[model samples]
Target: MIESSHTSPSAGWAARRLAELHLAAVFLTRLPLPHLRPPLPALSAALWAFPLVGAGIGLAGGAVLMLASAVGLPGPLAAGLALLATVLLTGALHEDGLADIADGFGGGATRARKLEILRDSRVGSYGVVALLLVVGLRWQALASLAANPLSAALVLTAAHALARASVPWAMVLGRPARSDGLGAAAGEASLVIALITLAVGMVVAVGLVPALALPMAGLMLTITAGIGWVATRQIGGYTGDVLGAIVLLSETAALMAATR
Candidate 1:
């Protein structure tokens, strides 16, 4: 779920879109786009650009992997560098979300307690274990793809793009868990925005690696659907942490699928 958005019709179409992309870049990354003057697009309106953000992230990480490999780094080390680049770029936004969700869901005994735990900034044993498992899985999968630069780039790019497309869908999975959190703050995104985002992700991912189109799409959809379903069952709806978990898990699965 996109956490913040603001838009005004006063801005021209091109400028509005640029601003929207800028907004997405800022929220989803550590990019230095700063404040959009005025006449900014709403947070929900900028949701469609989430895939672009993912593509950029994937490309950035893939580039580092390729470059590091070119400089004689081992595939495993190159993959680690690539993952580090992404973590630095995004400030581990999704990873942090994943950890929070794991800790909250695994430790909390009740819905209210779960929400409270999600809000806590501290990491628990559950969060640490979950992060270790998912991050380890991602690192190993990426290392496997590092044998070919082209394949590495395509898979990484597709994985990130398709993974982020799940955001809007995750947002729409159900009502917000908290009236004051990400779910409620993101508001109700239109079906159109969600479809456009999905379309962009499909085009980018399939275009990058046409051979794995079905697998990529299938794993992404499956992981996201499963995560969203679990979120709904656990807390009646999706939370910010739940959405983050969706992004990381989906991305991890996509990267794994790419290995095929």
Candidate 2:
């Protein structure tokens, strides 16, 4: 006694999956989503697309660099501008997370105190130092890589994607640090999703930059595990801000592998 539309089950599933992708894109980027009104379930399901969003952002940043170079800008200048574009696109989401994690871990004496520090809106000394190191090192690395636009684009694309994949990777390995907040709200991700995320990231990264694949993957995985360990020890679990720190540090490690 049910009225059915023309949509098949497989087609409906595909449509829902595509909606999750759109949700991920909207959440991760500054881009507008006029038609899509994804629910909280969609958001939770979209974690796998986090790296895909990074790929889009990285490619856009790389394109900006290419355009700048074509216009006669110096490699350093173009690199800085590309970094600026990425910051703008993501609204410095990960950057802010990095700052908070630094302030929390560096300044807090106890776990509760650390969590309290992280929730503050204002940046602290630890946060400032962390931001400077991350931004400065990223700028320098991008500048050096910018000498070869093709290589720069490939590595940036791969690094961003792989770095983002580390978030769910951490979530899979650690529990939420708090009872409530963004980290908890993300819910629990499964190991299968984590593995798929890592696999996709690995394939894309190695496919693009075959020469530095082994070293880059080795460094990225080591750094990712190291950050996860530090977060687990310091806070007893992972937080949203910790996930952000993981992305920035993981990307930096990968980019460093490509540096000459």
Candidate 3:
């Protein structure tokens, strides 16, 4: 009998990709999966799976929205619950980053000072205001879409996937601002990985909201590029906080575009 071992390489590749995706999910969300070694290289290497993980988060949140709405809850309340679901799903990981970036960039006078503020555990007035405004915008957008729960779910799912894709594009935007930490450890994704991330995100987003894809694309590109530019100018390069802010900002913008 022939060993028929020709399938080994492709099988192995699939296994590795699955493991990488699992790793990406663990890093991006508070999902309960078996523990695996989180080597920094592996985290950055798994950037290609960012959209997949994000889609899962969005789906979970959207399901909550649909369920709440189906139960006869008010649109505002259902939308609020949906937003809460995603926030708790990701353990507020990106929200913390957004706050930190806001506090750091708005409060610090020098580059070193800005970096110091970013590392602080305490939130400032700037952080508070940033969170309120951004999260409020998200709530309002979700409420508007809640009129049609199915449509809201689709838009939310796409927004999550597309926003995450922005993170990888940023990897190639500028060098890391610090010598250590998640940002530097993440480093820059290779062009292939970055492009694949973008492609997957676009495919998921467009497939979900075909008619709104054009507007989502334009808005996402503008916000992502604008955030990347601001991050580079303010701190010399991307940090974890900056990337987190980008995801939230881009996601909100996409949702708004879909609602519009």
Candidate 4:
């Protein structure tokens, strides 16, 4: 009963649209649609899927850690595997963002200067420190929660989904710092998708940690808004790096909250 864009309602248009959307989601996330070629519209959908992608990555990481534990892997080794899985799954995209943001915010004397710093590929002292702290915090949090594999998995899934959701909100609430690049592509629908993802993430979190989900969601939202404001003020908008930093920080915050 669906129609194609080129045809009437009987042409399977809705099905095709859904297919395009799925392609976009796979491209943006880790859904493993290996056969489809990446197209612009699909890429657009993928952008919305970024948070879901993170959630998938988190789920995989947790599952790996759980499996290792079941098979009697050492606790440290299992935790390390989970961490490594996350890194590999995301290709450390957000980690790089966090570092860039740190360098830009720490080393620049003015807002314009900060934005310039973020564009630079060279890492700085602030970047190094920030990366170290983030990695350390994540490791500690995961290790502490290792005893409860299911809880850890839930935390990872929730964190990733929440982190990605921040990107759309940032795109909606803030301006794009540059005329071109990834940030500019984020539009109103993307922001809506991000909000919906956030709501779903919160629901999942509540199921895992009933006493803490509400407060955690509030904290995540507050931090996301603060970061967006800072980025907007500094660069007149956001860039891919800013979005990445938001994801990293939000995820870390969620992890910490769940542990508490």
Which pairs of residues collide in model 1?
5-42, 5-43, 6-40, 6-41, 6-42, 6-43, 7-40, 7-41, 7-42
Better of 2 and 3 by lDDT: 3
CA lDDT, every model vs. true structure: 0.87, 0.84, 0.88, 0.74
Tens digit of per-residue lDDT, candidate 1, span 1-260? 88646655555577878988998898889877678878767778898899899999999999999999899999999999999999998999999999999988899999999989999999999999999999999999999988997689789988898888888887765678878987688778777888898898999987999888668878877887898888888888888788888889999998887776
Which ranges of candidate 4 are over 4 A from the true structure?
1-32, 35-39, 42-48, 188-191, 203-212
Top lDDT prediction, candidate number:
3
For candidate 1, report its TM-score.
Answer: 0.94
Instruction: Give the per-residue Cα lDDT of candidate 4 at 210.
Output: 72
Q: Model 2, clash count? A: 0
The sequence of per-residue lDDT tens digits that candidate 3 reaches over residues 154-224 is 99999999889888777776678899988988756887888898889889987999887767767777787
Stronger candidate by lDDT (2 vs 4) = 2
Tens-digit lDDT string for candidate 4 (1-260): 97655756755667565565565455444545656543435343444455556677788889988998889887667777998888887678888888998999889988778978988989999999999998888778877787878778777777776667676677667778887766775444455566666776666666656776676677668777999898877778788898888878887887787777
Positional deviation of 189 in candidate 4, in angstroms? 4.5
Off by over 4 Å in 2: 1-6, 38-42
Report residue 145 deviation for candidate 4 (angstroms): 0.7
Compute the lDDT for candidate 2. Answer: 0.84
